[model samples]
Target: MLPTNSCSSPTMSSPELKKVTVSLPKRLDRSSERWHHYLTIDLIWYVLGYTLFHPWTSWILVLCLRAQYTKYHAPEMKIAMAWAMLMSAIGIFHIFSERLAFGSPREVDLSDEVIVITGGVDGLGGLLAETYGMRNANVAVLDTKRVDDEEAEEKGVLYYQCDVSDAKQVEAVAAEIVEDLGPPTILINNAGIAHTKSILDTTAEEVEQTFRTNTLSHFTTLRIFLPYMLREGRGTIVTVSSVLGHLGAANLSAYSASKAALLALHHSLRAELAQNPAAQEIKTILVTPGQMSTKMFVGVTTPSNFLAPVISPAEIAKSLIRMIEKGDSGELAVPLYAQYIQILGALPVGMQAIIRRWSGVDTAIAKAGLVKKDTSEKQ
Candidate 1:
């Protein structure tokens, strides 16, 4: 038997509920930047891929011709059939190409995996960390920046203050992560810094630091955390480089060089893993994004917005998360131009020069006043 309060029915006052306002950070609105923002080449290509260029859509034209009682040998009917066959063949070739290049994807269970991300406090890494954290996965971030207790709790992630460039620091954090969460099964080497300075103006110390942070950090983290994955018999490694690695730009020598080294390192890592029976399940992903909309390149402008619009960190983060969840290993080059940048190098020298001049890749930093000055004083 439950006893009721006798005074409750005398007079009951309802408490007023106040509305709590939540403020979110302001994001850059690229849509309102220019009149042509809505008409990017990427948007045009995307539309074509889904409609005119799609195999099913191409076949639909043939069906429409048949429905109109057009003769099979008619020019329009023949053209439509041929186009449909071509589109279908291209689609089948793409499927085979992906299978040949990346092989079959492995099974991924997020609940059973521990992910370690470098530079996870901000930018692309931050977006990825928060995404995985939201899904309640075991995530550990190693960065020089420290996240406060309240923020860490709200984000559902563990932030370790450690410079991933240092091998000893990485090893220390690896031990702590193993104790706190578990052995790391996913490694995202995305920590990078850039100095927009010409090679002649850049100092040796600056170059060394750039390599240590951007390039050597991958090696350090891999050396420390990879053994755990090997012992565990499965893992995934993601290397975040830049498309500028393939196209060397003026006033970005150190950064481009560091990223280029990563391209080579990725292939080497994959080759080594392939040779090991225990590492067959250890997949690798390479990301080469072009001019992300992050603080690192705040003032740098894209030469051609129609062809090479600046990619958002959120966009890249989503693609990366998709690949990881699918357990697929492959290369990701965003922006339509990034995928074809390699072909630029193989073009005729005169054509390359003309394209470079028109694209302004070599002059963008200087024009934007982003080039760093040498500290040395003229005597």
Candidate 2:
């Protein structure tokens, strides 16, 4: 671990310094890329949001009509004015609804907060940890993966080698974190593992491992670390789930079930926190992202690039950081589809099945031949 006093040490170079020296990975080749890659529903929606849906943009349209000497009673002018008012009303209502649901956001000072991230050695967790470290936040990472002392020091993060799935290990690590950094006020539970196997094909051991890592780890961390937040009377707990959790796939039975459990857990955490008077300042953020370009889903392909474009870890991280800093409890669902997935469950059973089949939700893994085989097959 780097010395606690290393933050002020001039000898310790910033992690960004390594970025200058290290060669970055090459961008994906254009020849192999498809036209669909450049065009997605998300891109179109984003453009529409800024141009068509934006209140200011709507007003601009009205202004254009007026500039053209259109009378207020003219059909085009009336439509434009009505549209602008509707957009403005929607924007105002959205802000008011958010405030009503989450209450006021608490002030977040990065310097005063100690951030703890599980699975911080790699992927989204690593990205968040490094970002905070660069900002000189007291950052601690608990993961089974170990980072070398020099690299950890250079990154300005304390790496704790702990298997977060194990309650004992998490408890021990929590103690160390409390001692190293002050009691962690920001808890990011992003550690998860997946076994691409059918229910029958998945062994009990593998299923147990998946649950331990994905679901139980949240309980372990919360049980151990939540009291610290309670004592401090303020904290932000981030739960990273998956869109597949709501729409279970054929070959991802164990993985999906575990993530599904997290959805319930997140809501339970929020409800319980609401009951506690002292927990009013404790914010809970739930992140349900669609297929991300992380190593966990490296070979996995989305069924529809237009509908469910693969999200970047960086995008999710940015949203999480923003929510955490704003100290607001909210759900961060990416790829538009993820946000509205619950609507699928509300549809007719026959329609739901048809939609699922059309979306190729159950067949993606099997078609890709990425299904995990029995241990006997490997042997």
Candidate 3:
């Protein structure tokens, strides 16, 4: 016979609730030797940006000088004011320049917008798809890899097995995506492949495959998805490229060349969009990440960790997601060095060669046994 009294059951107490703790992973303490060794030129530059190079901090010097009742004509006061004005002017100019270049941001409603991500089976693309899916956004992931139905459902993403490099497959996939998720308002053109052999060693077929996957895929996707965006009158296209595009590498000639084509394609897309009145709300984002710490470049070593650090796929994913959510057009070049890679081309040939050699660009692929014959999706 069961007891009828409610007192027989244990009552929840405040202390019991208070005793419950949500355990989290311990914070990383990077005060060790390896941590110090990991610090590099980019870290120093980042620190300076928030300190010495900060416009607000520069103005503080001018304010301090005035507080001391320093005359405007005085050398110290004049120098301080000049520095402050220069910094302030530069900062304001940058704001205006960005506004003028990109125009106003379009409204992004994830619930109403369809998101299409290519090469989303693994790596960076997978992260992006999963994130949007988790947010209850309509997400379609196109990849050659066959993901199980249960896994796709658990991740909240629609997976379509299609090779984006082939125009027929892309067209078919586009129809499927539209039918399933409505017209895609966000297109992340991330399909790519790399050929690591030297120019002389690379086969003709390998070069063709590299260009087809890395460069042609962009055109194919744009041709298929862009019409939908034009009809909708709003969208965002994100192009994933590489810093190697700006600096052609030795053993990575074909891979670098294919990426370089994306740089041009991005520019062309923007120019074409500018001419169209319907594309006023359409945004384009160019992602140029330097040596991402993915399996694509598993054993490759960066000459200087600090100067050209290996960026993680997660880092790139966050930036890409931010841009997409903001509904803005911009270029994202990570690891600091990628942003300044263009300058190397403007330098003297001998000087450029010296820098390349010093940076171990020519020897990096061969050194790490990175010449994998695998025909896999690129970064």
Candidate 4:
């Protein structure tokens, strides 16, 4: 038994927490011989953001020039001043744009919030649920995977074995969650399944099943859980989508299409929520993460590690938790490319084809031998 005065019993002391760990999930692929294997475009962008693009940091160049006794009219000083002003403008624009698009962030207290996550048995969902559960927060996880009572007690989370695809089942589980925990103040619709097959090869049943879990589950949860949020006067809804949704892949047609529907659904949800005065405090977050190092993409390989690096599920979870706790309403697109994928649509067809060919989005699944039998779920 844990000590009565033990402060770290759940989080730090629970060293044997099998599914979720305190540290971030280690990346699977570290086999590259090159020293720059970990040096991704996203990493470079992050460093540049703080050093060069940051308003205050950019102005440091002006300070250095002044200390060197350089005149203001000198070329180096003028260039420095111009760069500083540009950075300042960019910083100001970012703040104003964020405020205008999402309005002000709401207040969120995790302890007071009853958090519910669909497909929280493993993967990104599991990471989210377990993190909050460890903190002694009211966390309920819904998934097809069953967790024994002992395991549930150990993790400090209530596990409900329910098929998220079924509307009736979700409704039934919702009632149980309301009874066990308080009304769910945070809803994470993170359940998804992928059937890696071409359009012609994929069966009708497979297509429906894919949509049922990947897309339709969001509608089911929102219909049931959103009302409670409205009644509670504050809540946060998170929708987990894929970067592949914008760029349809060859073998992953059903999966990509299903995720694509969520993009539209999220926008529609935002519009509806905006019309409701009761939902003024309801914050929405849309996460479109790139290929993550999860069970779903075990065999899949990135075309370029530098440009399209495999992201860890814990990394994605960390970003989501921060946004939800901060009560911000916005989209979280991981990696540098995922955020700007929409630009591909504006490009000329030939140029777009060339880019896609180079990216190898279509051939990755085929190369990985992801046939019809190799279906995987993202929890």
Highest TM-score: which candidate? 2
Each model's Cα RMSD? 4.7, 10.0, 5.7, 9.2
| Per-residue lDDT of 316 in model 4 | 88
Give per-residue lDDT, candidate 3, residue 14. 35
Across residues 1-379, which tens digit of lDDT does each residue of candidate 4 receive?
7757736645455557467656544655556567788899999999999998899998998999999999999999999999999999989999999988888899988779999999999899999988988999999999999999998999899999999999999999999999988899999999999888877777788899999999999999999999999999999999999998899999899999999999999999999999999999999999999989899978888889999999999888888999999999999999789999999999999999999999989998888887665345422
TM-score of 4: 0.88
Ranking by TM-score: 2, 1, 4, 3
Estimate the TM-score for candidate 3.
Answer: 0.85
Which TM-score value belongs to model 2? 0.89
Candidate 1 achieves a global lDDT of: 0.91
Return the lDDT, model 1, position 74: 100
Q: By the TM-score metric, which is better: model 2 or model 4?
A: 2
Q: Write the per-residue lDDT of candidate 1 for residues 58-112, one digit (tens) a residue.
A: 9999999999999999999999999999999999999899888777788889999
Evaluated against the true structure, the overall lDDT of model 3 is: 0.88
Off by over 4 Å in 4: 1-33, 373-379
lDDT tens digits by residue: candidate 2, 120-177: 9899999999999999999999999989999999999999999988899888888888
* lDDT accuracy of residue 164 in candidate 4: 94
